[model samples]
Target: MKRREFFKKGTTAAVAAGVIPLVTASCVGAKDMVYDRKQDKWFDLGTGKTGSNSRKKTVAYDVAVIGGGAAGICAAVAAARNGSKTVLIQDRPVLGGNASSEMRVHLNGVNNIKGKAERETGIIEEILLHNRFENEQESFPVWDHVLYDFVVREPNLTLMLNTQAIEAVMDGDKIKSALCWQATTEILFTINAPVYIDCSGDGLLAATSGAEYRTGREGKAEFNEKFAPDEPDGWQMGATLLMSSKDMGKPMKYSPPSYAIKYTHEGGHKRRKFAGFHEGIWWIEVGSDDDIIADFEENRHKLMGYLHGVWDYIKNSGKFPEAENLALDWVGSLPGRRESRRFIGDYIVSEKDMTEHKHFDDAVAFGGWSLDEHNPGGIENISEPPSYFHYHFEEVYQFPFRSLYSKNVSNLMFAGRNVSQTHIALSSSRIMGTCALMGQAVGTAAAICNKKNVLPREVGQKYIKNLQEQMLRDDAFIPKRPANDPNDLARKASLIFGSTTSSGDAKKLINGFSRDIDGKNNHWQSDGLSADLQLEWESSISLSYVELKCDTNLQRNIMMRKDSRNDELYFNGIPNELLKSLSLEARVNGKWIKLGVIEENRTRLIKFKFDTIKTTAVRIKMTETYGAENVKLFEVRCYA
Candidate 1:
């Protein structure tokens, strides 16, 4: 049978009947597909001075992650690092969807919760810290390069820019291939994988694959969401055009463009006050209830007009003299979008799940951002507040694994704003940081799915613990869940102690809680610098790696903000509590032998991997920190 015919009839029937007695061209056989510049020859065409060659390329990966935003990057990195050959496809030249240099939106996670930040850990934390180390100047354009560096350095991942996954080749309910169009190269790409992750906020691939999805706001009756609209409407949260102004050190004149609408703010809501107009104004936005995606260009023009109008009001109006020296420095032509299609999953996260702190047995991630529901008609409706700021969370809540995968499509998964959630739930969970946690969870789960040769649902159903444990081992903090991997030698050690302790017990390191919470200490704090923490096993065990989750002060966020706001809640620079110098030694043949050393550590999770050796005891000597007088660590893990 022809490839297309087999895929359409045979593969579809086999998949629907829950049988796999078809030709090798099915999903399982797709791994044999390969795409390298060496193999496919592009024939020379005499159509133009430069040969215009167009061909289709089919590349196979274990995981195909669509989008290159914070969530997509984290998902791709997590999947790649967890032993999956992954490919990350981005429509834009740069990564970081909303937080990119193009949008200049702040890469915010759980910035503030009850006066302290419950910062996201794992891959996302690593990314934020990477930026802190590399982009000290806090330049947005440089940050673009930083994100690019983060993705390209991953050996197991392939990044395709200027590529859009417009269509999906379906085998029954599963996505067999994604046909992506690369505008720059003018090449069509068919990316086949066992698992397809739609981290793109709009979820084009999932939508094309016939994955069930919902758009716009959900009514209160749908999920008993207190913060949801009283009656369901087609209104999706708007997108905002951002602009930054600079102080010219002299009085600057301003003029409104022809497209600029006249802004009076005459009947504006009291909550629409512009406190930080020097930076971008978040209220200069627009939304559409019906087909918001189709209204993107239309709203974008209005956003630009509204942005300048608001600026004109701020500069010309006699409201205040604060804008005398401020001149418009940077204006974003592309508006940062917030809401889009939310794909259906086994479990739809509702407002109560977050507000009531509902715990899920399959919990693999956490989120704590407030229910910040943007008003129906942003800026256009001046009577209402820009954001309702519905509800604030006191503590982080668990996000279920069931909500990360598609309900109808067997192998499709999603993260970011497009995940399975109610409109009210998205209000809080839509934060990039929270979405990143979900990304890591699904990415790790995708690797698991590939290893077991199973679909996403089976992994969540039977091997959820395995997925959760793997994520925990990688330093992902799951709320209300502690890392208890049986393979961790640190937990099995006969004795674990510290050289000095200012507060908290040394045994807390083995307790599995990687962060201090609920007024309970889960860390080992040295009274002063140059401390020794050792773990001894009753019997010698073969070890090759020692991982430690050092102190980075999770309470203060380290994400790059346009204002570079430094306060009690946020740290503009690197955390002073991070371990700067550390060395690991193994007690081999009764004598201590130095195994590895880290002179300058940038990651919160430090690793010491070497050849396997039989050692009864392991000693970690931390000599210095960035600035803190003492050194602290939450957990220590050893693996073979």
Candidate 2:
């Protein structure tokens, strides 16, 4: 009756009977096992194959990612980087499902601190940096290639493009394998893994494998979410087919397709064009509120017609003087869907969690974008406005790890827009940046689970805490602050340097360093530091070590003097002669502190220290001899 023995016997029996086995009594215990006589298998199965009749293939992986979007990519990279044998199965020919180059939708996420640079970390960050370097500006196709290159180059990652995961194989409550179809070869291959992640934005794997999920919005009372509708509504946000056009100098004749005119103005105004309008910003019209997968064909035809009509209108009308030279540039091959099946995980993140800024015990990621929900119906229904709710918190709110794994299905974890969150909550966290962070968390968690041989739900907060710390070290920001207090101070100092309310003393010091000098700080004045100035001085002095000193601890104040011409330097501390024989470097606390030298002026501070004067003088002489020309000395006052 031991679990291992039972699993062995059960698997053997199922294989002999040609039946697909679901859960093994050994894994879940007899009381938890429910046999399905009709299917000739155990209930609560994750793998698609049933009874002995199903095809079987041998494959093994440390971690398996079921989608190739932002989440899947991050998850796979994190696992691989962490030394896990990771495999990524993507249904599409190219990566970047919604934000792909073929789809041509810009990745949208609010930069940290409003004006700070975008958060780029892990594999996704590398790709973004490469793209920036290659294009100098944003180019969708180039960005896509960079993403592709990142995955392909990773040594521990196995990327199976154009492969669809049709079924998940489960041993008791854990996923053992997934059956995927290779589009090119039409061969079904099995991928076995100790851990699996569901990044398919549609929750395809969770649904097919019997993972518990929800398809529509929840009632307001369930989670006490203020944004939820009074009653459960089946309606979900619509999808859009993005379009683009180029200037052609003269309008070209075009014919409208039959379904292009589906919308007639209720007030008797002429119908508006829907496609071939402008560049990147133009989005064509199509069906909404209807079944997206089922009606996709009809919608495509209507969109084509709309494009033709738009071109016709441009040729015949004189409204667009600037667009007279426009021509059809490109159109999206697939529509970008915003909402789909939301899997029910161990925890459901609600709007209240976001609005109230609720902090979770197992926080993994943070999101700051506003709650922006597009209506279930497409653009035609302009009678009602789109839902827009902003979080009151100036900082990003933390998301818990529980929301990433399914409550009913023990093994599966999900990320991206399909994470276990209500529609309103998803509106804010669904952005690519947040999703990338979630992906990193999931990948790291999966690796931990695989190494520890524990379920993701059972991994506990300590593991998640470790993962968050690692993420911060890797440059991905989470809700929590970093451990290094000095880093915090340095960041604060950087911000203060550029602020308008900077003190007169601070401004004088900044200016004296020469507003735009190179390392020497001797070139043109007021030009500001050149772009090549090394903010990160790997081979130079450590800026953090530099500090100001005063003779008296109680009255420790230094005045920075500025001349009428706005060019001067002054330092106050112990007089220079007192410490004349001490060899002291201009380094503050072992960090380099540079003072721009004025050749003809007496603009240097005196120094004094309690230690032997010889050692201090030696340090100073060494610094003055080898330091860059811009380096200067200031009075070092001994405080008692």
Candidate 3:
């Protein structure tokens, strides 16, 4: 019998006998079938190939973070470090969604905003500083391990790689557990948690949990955005398959595959650009006019053909002599998506909120990138430019806590490209650096919720100050606002200086400005190498933790780059102005007692913890800096 007829007969016979057989090409020869008791079904996934015996597993945590990209990484680390048991679930073998080795897109943030260098701080800055300390070469694969190290090193975080969150176990409006399928181990994971964060760029977990969301471009009349189209349409930014090339120092041969596309100068020369060979090409994109989520596989296949076609043209076309020795080094298999389903929140961010700088009382995060909109035609249109610049912001815009949580679902919250915003607003807020800040905000809020035993909405309404105070204590910056913790014991005490400051007053340390920005002069700088700043009170008080905000040079860049190096920013060693050695002390019974000392400090925020004691005075002693002669600090606080 013919192949088609034989498979059809086999399928019919299996259905009649109440036994479903693997007849399709995807399930042709799989003999291993495991029955899931919880799901009450059978799965024929190819997990035996990885050589693992377990087929099912269960776990619990205080918080669960889905999608191990920039937002998810920050969320998991922030939640874990803030004293919450957190679990991170990732679908890919490695971390970093778009900036990973699998998809080598540059992690852009407010750096590209106008011409000023405004880098994001907090957990994102910590990750970049780690990369600068370890991966100096800026290798993509090495960057993957750098992200891995950041997640695994956290003591309270549990990372589960190669696990895709397939289903959401919901109880009424809350997510009871996240059911994930581990492809390599062939095991199903049911992770239960009180709070859930959906940092997945595509909003996969939100969609499965019945969270209301919006997709496609909004009409001009909807949000009154000038850049929006006249009518609404199901069009989104295209997915890109970034490709990189390297010179072999010798000639390399090339041949086109059967599935590769055929292109000429008339088809792609005028529209597409191929100037840099070392970095991945971002123009070879697809899937703007089609459904990005429902038709993901088809879109990815089409992008692969287009990518190979571009490479073929560069090598075989013989148009440029620079391509003689250059060969394709890496081509991404996974397409880095730009836009998809966005959860609907209480407030939908509009273009006016970004351009006019609207005030949000519960602002947790901010963004400053330009409104960059890509053409819907994608690669199919060669008549227009690949992108259209809509508008730029005079200053950074604030993101509200109302826009970060679900309006319908009680326990759901999201970050990254899928936040609550219109299409025009998303064009600016979609950058990875801005997304990282949102992750930090939501994660900090999640920790507060777990501690107080309240939902996300309650945190926004009643305990907003608690969330803001925690973020500032952890070194996160809130635009136009200063950290003033009323519960802090240092706020009620008097501050004294051991020595005079040169540039600014020593009283600036208690003014609550942690970062130095334009028109803001609140930092205290000492005159000489070693100086002391002491906090004294009339009566003795019990203290356990001391938080210090130092200067790490926020005006310069510290991230790893692929192109030419900027020695001023991306140096081989640590920043020159960072404090390297410091010590904390307290005076009890007329004698100074050393509490803690740090010989090597690499971060902007430093915390000293010791046994609780009643002391009348606390002192911070500094000895040496990385390079600067004078010691500079932003804020100092004591908590009991």
Each candidate: what lDDT? 0.88, 0.56, 0.80
Ranking by TM-score: 1, 3, 2
List the candidate 1 regions with Cα displacement exceeding 4 Å: 1-52
Cα lDDT of model 3 by residue, 434-503, tens digit: 8999999999989988999999999999999888888877887778777888877877776666575888
lDDT by residue for model 1 over 1-640, one digit each (tens)?
3322322353233233222212123434543222223444445465434423335688999999999999999999999999999999999999999999899888888888778888989999999899999999999999999999999999999999999887678899899999887878767788999999999898877876777777778888989988887998778899999999999999999999999988999899999989988888898989988667767999999999999999999999978599999999999999999997898999999999999999899999888889998998999999999999998888888999889999999999999999999999999999999999999999999999988999999998899999999998899998888888998888899999999999888899989899998677899899997999999999999999999999999999999998898998888888999999999999999999999999999999999999999999999999999999999999999999
Clashing pairs in 3: none
TM-score winner among the candidates? 1
RMSD, one per candidate, in order: 6.6, 15.6, 6.6
**Model 2: runs farther than 4 Å from truth?**
1-57, 111-123, 262-277, 280-292, 303-318, 386-393, 484-640
Q: Model 2 lDDT vs. the true structure?
A: 0.56
lDDT of 1: 0.88
lDDT of 2 by residue, 201-233 (tens): 876566556676555577788888787789866
Error of 1 at 632 (Å): 0.2
